[model samples]
Target: MPQAAPMLRVENLAVTRGGLPVLEGLGFTLEAGQALVLRGPNGIGKTTLLRTLAGLQPALAGTISMPPETMAYAAHADGLKSTLTVTENLSFWAAVYGTGAIDAALDRMNLRQLADRPAHSLSAGQKRRLGLARLLVTGRPVWVLDEPTVSLDAASVALFAGAVRAHLAQGGAALMATHIDLGLSEATVLDLAPFKARPPELGGIAGSFDEAFA
Candidate 1:
């Protein structure tokens, strides 16, 4: 089989919040057909890293190489417009990416029936599903997801895992920061806890936490 191309590459990345370093000297690469999970405790900068990768936050240092339109980001906030219906939200994203069909994406995320319902009227998990449905309408090869499984029930989580597996199988890549265990044995987990910086030195916590989450 032919090899897939690299989807995202981060080199010597460092980020700061409130002028305090959060990630230091971090680097990683994600290729098409693979998945990398960002794992860490709360307040450890996992979300920040995802935001940086998504281009929603600026990196204090280093380079993030990837095409913006070729990337799909599902943030922790659900990224929904309260006044819009679920269908409207998905359709809006579909228009943004200019690829795939909105209805199909909603079907994939199991939100077809809730299409006309206002975003704020849905439950937390339903809103999350709607957020993920946005990605399905995009042809992006790189996925940056933060807490992708926030409020999913057992079946919904399983559905999401299946979608992720399908994406990987199709030569797409995903960078996700999630608390839920994905059960993807082949996934590479990058723990960010130790990478949280101290007050003075912009360095990470002592020791190697890279392999802990793997």
Candidate 2:
């Protein structure tokens, strides 16, 4: 049988922060039900790559081919409203994404117990769980996540791994930038160091040296 087209495709992709190139010549393709883990040291532009793919920032060069509505991005920050209750926060995203079934998301993230608590009142791990829960309600095929397991406990990490597996089983894909092992045996690993951008030649600088640092 013929293979299905990729859910996301990035070719010769380059990203910049503050007008300084950070990543370049990065290429990858993700198929349905697959996951790609981005591994690199700090300041190597993992988060920048994710943001570029999510359209929050523009790529300095190259191409990214993925349907706009098919992607859902979760950043390092939980992006929660401090005053809103857990359910209300999720409900808001659900409405925005045109997806229902908030209860199922809460249950999956083990967040049903804290459903009524204000986001500011939750612990770090709780907040991360809430952020992960938003992915469930997105109903989007591709997930672009940054440091998803940060501040999560061992049990919560396992819960998140299970959620990723479930999403793959349902034919969704994920591209994640994380430092820890998420226990995903089937996910492919992509090291960002190979794509780290070289310093620009003289007279090619786009901004001041201080501004070029990401």
Candidate 3:
């Protein structure tokens, strides 16, 4: 018998937003080639958990261990440069992540035709594809996606699912937060609300809409 490799491991994770604990002592492991979908009502900290895992937000307490250079995050904002052409944006991330498969990524997302167009000119769904294509270009083994299919059309959503399947085939892992079903057959689900708790003190900035939403 051999021990299994964990693409991502989270133990005793605790997170708070505006003095409310959204996650408490939540534990899970994502093995290579698997997908885990985080599900819950809005403001229950589904997005927060993803951001925390991406190291974008501070986790009050927890241990998150993952492989080096193997994790990629697809934030809700898409993170595309409005002024740059789609190809330019992908090229930039490729160099940053040191991945040499720009063409393959473009092809995967079906964005080759729009490669020369400015990101701002792309439709919402196209932008989502572009955002996802970045991960393909990076070739990271672990993906943390927040509302990945928010604006995608039916075909595009199916396309995204295909990309996910391909990624898994390559032994990658994914943790995604989505309201709609992603139609992924092999995915497992984790509900964040059960572990939800309010933070102790939201402080002066607590009155903002972010806290209100939380």
lDDT of each: 0.81, 0.91, 0.85
Worst 10 residues of 3 by lDDT: 202-211
Candidate numbers, best TM-score first, in rank order: 2, 3, 1
Give the per-residue lDDT digits (tens) of candidate 2, residues 1-214: 1268899999999888777788888999999999999999999999999999999888878999986699999998988999999999999999999997799999999999999999999999999999999999999999999999999999999999999999988889999999999999999999999888877773332534374434
Worst 10 residues of 2 by lDDT: 202-211
Candidate 1 lDDT, tens digit per residue, 1-214? 2565567889888876544567777888998888999988887788788877878767777898875667888877878999999988888888877764787778788998899999989999999888888878887878889889988999999888888988888788899998889888778999887666665533453323243321
lDDT of 2: 0.91
lDDT comparing candidate 3 with the true structure = 0.85
Ranking by lDDT: 2, 3, 1
**Which residue runs of candidate 1 sit more than 4 Å off their true CA positions?**
198-214
For candidate 3, write residues 192-214 as lDDT tens digits.
87776644463211223355444
Off by over 4 Å in 3: 1-3, 198-214
lDDT of 1: 0.81
Which predicted model would earn the best lDDT? 2
Q: List the candidate 2 regions with Cα displacement exceeding 4 Å.
A: 202-214
| Clash pairs for candidate 3 | 19-198, 19-199, 20-197, 20-198, 20-199, 21-197, 21-198, 21-199
Better of 1 and 3 by TM-score: 3
